[model samples]
Target: MIVDDEQPAIELLEKYVSMLPNLEVVATSYSAIEASEILKKESVDLLFLDIQMPLLTGLDFLKNSKNLPKVILTTAYREYAIEGYDLDIVDYLLKPISFERFFKAVQRYYQNSDRKNIISESVPERNHIYVNVNKKNHKVNFDSILYIESLKDYIRIHTSTKSLVVRMNIGSILQELPGSQFVRVHRSYIVSKNKITAYTSTDIEIGTIEIPIGQTYKEIVEDLCRS
Candidate 1:
């Protein structure tokens, strides 16, 4: 789904989406009202929305949707970023979007949906979780993290590119992370699938660093490896 008043923007986005595999443009609209009508009759997995539109803005359209699809906001204004994040959008893309950035945003949406399905299938008991560290609250990108390890009272978060230290219990941190991509491999350690490099019975290596695997968590680790 693509929505924009500007014909060129819609055309460019359509071209970009067409280049990707397994993605089809279900619909495109110049106004929110027209989009609403189309949405009423069809199901869309992704929406490329423009923020500034006459009558009903993209933000308003999203808020009014009964079943909202993953949205990527496209606009010339950068000020709407905070609002977009507040709405829990997949990504915020500025006007004249680069091919690389557009691809990354689409990739993020796919990854999020994939992990969500895995978690929903595996654990139906949990709803939401939170983790606090260094006096600053950090919401974990469940699919983006590789694992975590306890350092005294604090925990070190190892992602694909960087490691961050947060002051909190490992248990609390695990709750905030997405369960599909993360598992408690050891009492002190949590690892993300994308970050895992190597593993053995007693230890797991992420990149160049090795974390000890607790005796109790060995079975969990083995299960993950087999899966």
Candidate 2:
């Protein structure tokens, strides 16, 4: 699915997507509302959405949808990139998108989708897990965490305002967080999309601190941006 008010942009995307092997441009709409209607009646695996559209923007469409597919935000402005990532979009493409950038975004989605499937298969059925922090048992909400940082043998949990330190491995803590919201961006850092302030290829800024992005976790971070 592709939603954009500009015919040229839609045509360009349609042409580019057609060249891909396992992808298809299912639908195109000038308005978000029209796109919503189509989505309600059909199954769409991916959405190429324009952020600035009449009647409703791409963000508005995402908020209103009951079932969301992988979304790639297409916009003229770069300012919305952070917000788009916060919303867990698949990728952010600047206006006048080139074929190379578009292909990169699609490839990202495929990789992420494959990884998610593997994770989901291995996940146990549970809502929450216990974490021992500072010799006290702290019941952490899976969705409330912003990020986690490893400091020697202790791991710091950054919530909306509060921070808790627990003596545990970062990998152990990551297992407790919901896979959909939390992602490891560095060897020492795991971030929650709901609490991320901003991010780049090098770092993810959460609240007042900037967490480094490890080379091993770059693909995961990019996947997080597209989520």
Candidate 3:
């Protein structure tokens, strides 16, 4: 079963699932509410759930539901890896999800389901990240990012010399970034820690650009102050 609010995402996932000979897509839901209701009467083996949704989130729904199946979380956010793993999910996939990454996630799920002896890691290594824009993959170096800004349903990856606007959320792209270099200062902003020239309780200055710090991200600011 696949549960995502975006119809395009659902279609893309369905296309991918069809390629797997051993896998079959049972159902697809656009809302978590619909998925939750379906679960009450359906016996699903695996689930591809989205994180951000109206009314209820995928994480909360999974926690509240009974007889939960093997879940591979498909979301636009990467920050939820620790929390999702704490709930014992099979995998956490970031949005604009590539075929390679998607395949690897499913393979991990299959290995775990069959009780294979293999060590699994939640996040993958990256010296560069490939962003899908205009149906093309743009490769950006890890060291080039100044900051990331969320623009409604899109995100702008501001590099040292250029910027790439991807149809993805800020939370989703943060996964591909080098955590040591990048830090989430606000809900809509993520800055390259190394590029930060100045900062205060409310905002940070990266070169000439000023990015605000969210109220909930005060602890992150405190951590930076201590460091």
Candidate 4:
């Protein structure tokens, strides 16, 4: 669950949470009062909470609520670090949070909690993946995928019919794809193994399109040749 007054902050955290296969967002609230209401029905193992909210601050809510689950405080202010730690929060994240910092905070939670098995659990095989685009979930079949390109925080999924610019990172999207069908040929590219029409030491060709291969990924030359 993520609780923040700002919509962008909630969306940013949602994007981060999506990167972790084990983490699932159950709810998001714009205020502490709204979150309190949600807690009555939903059982959340972890809470990504913002310290400064409109009516009720995160610290005030924590003091008032009973049987509160583990918490990780998210705030831009530095003064509240001591107070937040006094509340026994799993971690404190200063905003604009980077993915590396966010990952470390999540690791802290796993180390402190007994639910470590959740991190190691394997995802079941699937032929398609549902990507959220324009506020809707679009079903993208693996067979239709030609290649994927990274655009910083976003990725473009090029398919047989069309392309979609999704708000996802390259590493996260790669985990969602099957290893046998897809390979990361470069830092910004993931190509379908079956779609490769031609290749060389420096690049791979899919149809008329040419995708560069990174120096570190040169081993893929031999791997693809064997495959």
Candidate 5:
């Protein structure tokens, strides 16, 4: 989902795709109108949208779209930073985007994504989940998990015996775990309720290990304690 009017800009983004092995480009468009058409046909998890384009600007397109995915704005101009953040965009990458900067922006997406999911609090629960890695899926029992950690577009499920990294987001993974058994305590962490032996305003204890509760998630920690 790279929507830039310039061919070279799009090519640069495509070139970086190899670095993100799990990334899949469903469609690429040179204009907001074309991108809108593609969105109607496919479900995109993330979008790298350009601000300057013909007909409809990237910001205008996003404002009109009913269902928006996690967006990272790629532009040469820096004037739109405040407006971009106001729309809750993942990150704002200045043009001629560097790999290091790109990866950092992506990491920010992972963090904000987990935070958004926790606030939504509508993920359906399940008792078990499948962890797919390198084309094979492994069934994992929820009760065995100590916690789940965010890995950008991936999630690392840490259990009593072993830790497995799957090419999936924590938001989607959280839905697969029983809500009663798992709790998203931080933007980067989801702790198993069964594994927590102690907790405070800022952190939760799972055995001897402690997981920090995100500042934005203070209400969650407080509400859970009251319940």
Candidate 6:
């Protein structure tokens, strides 16, 4: 079941649902009131719910409802994250949702679900990410990335083999990459922790290249060195 206020979001989730063989869309509602009414009749396994609605907000509805299924909160706002997690939501997805991120969220749902009928292919470790470059989605292995450099509106990802210029901000791309493997040492740079050869308080060395560590990141850099 998918409950969202916007028609486009519902359509997009429907498209994503169609891609998975095991997943099925039982119901879709534009408002929380309509969804509550549908829930009385339908036996839903999982719910993709939006945070904001007209009559009753998603959070308010969740608070008042009984015998609710496992929920995955879909919202554009980041402020309600802590409250959503407190309600024991399966996952919280920020919108303009990518298929990759959507797949991960579904995997989380399956992991948390008590149901035994699980899709084997739904859960798999991902080592690569697909990014749009020159109107084409290019698969770049996480291990191949040496460092990432910000170029105002665009970011140049420096890989071991080659560099790809992508039209994304530094902060947005950091969220996509694995946090454990990468560290942002400067405002304009994010370096792979595994790729570092040497480091001082002011700079980090990756083979022949030396990347300066910014003032704000000095403490974190020092901590990394200590660890």
Model 6 TM-score? 0.56
lDDT of each: 0.74, 0.76, 0.79, 0.83, 0.78, 0.84
Which clashing pairs does model 5 show? none
Better of 1 and 5 by lDDT: 5
Error of 4 at 122 (Å): 15
Give the 10-residue window scoring lowest on summed lDDT in candidate 1.
117-126
Candidate whose lDDT is highest: 6
**Model 1 agreement with the true structure over 117-169: per-residue lDDT tens digits:** 22121123233334555576665555557667778667787656666787766
Error of 3 at 85 (Å): 1.0
| TM-score, prediction 2 | 0.54
Ranking by TM-score: 6, 2, 1, 4, 3, 5
lDDT of 4 at 135: 100
Q: Candidate 5 on 8-96: residue-level lDDT in tens?
A: 99999888755775567888999999998898998988899999999999999888888878998999976665466546576777788
Model 1 CA lDDT for position 175: 33
- Candidate 3 vs. true structure, TM-score: 0.52
- In model 3, where do residues sit more than 4 Å from their true spots? 115-227
**lDDT of candidate model 6 versus the reference:** 0.84
Candidate 2, 1-227: lDDT as tens digits:
99999999999999987877567877889999898889888889999999998879888777777778899999997656545665767777887787766776675676567444221212133455567865778777776677888876678887765888887756446534555567778767888877788888898887787989988668877877776
Candidate with more favorable, higher TM-score: 1 or 6: 6
**Native-referenced Cα lDDT, model 5:** 0.78
Better of 3 and 6 by TM-score: 6
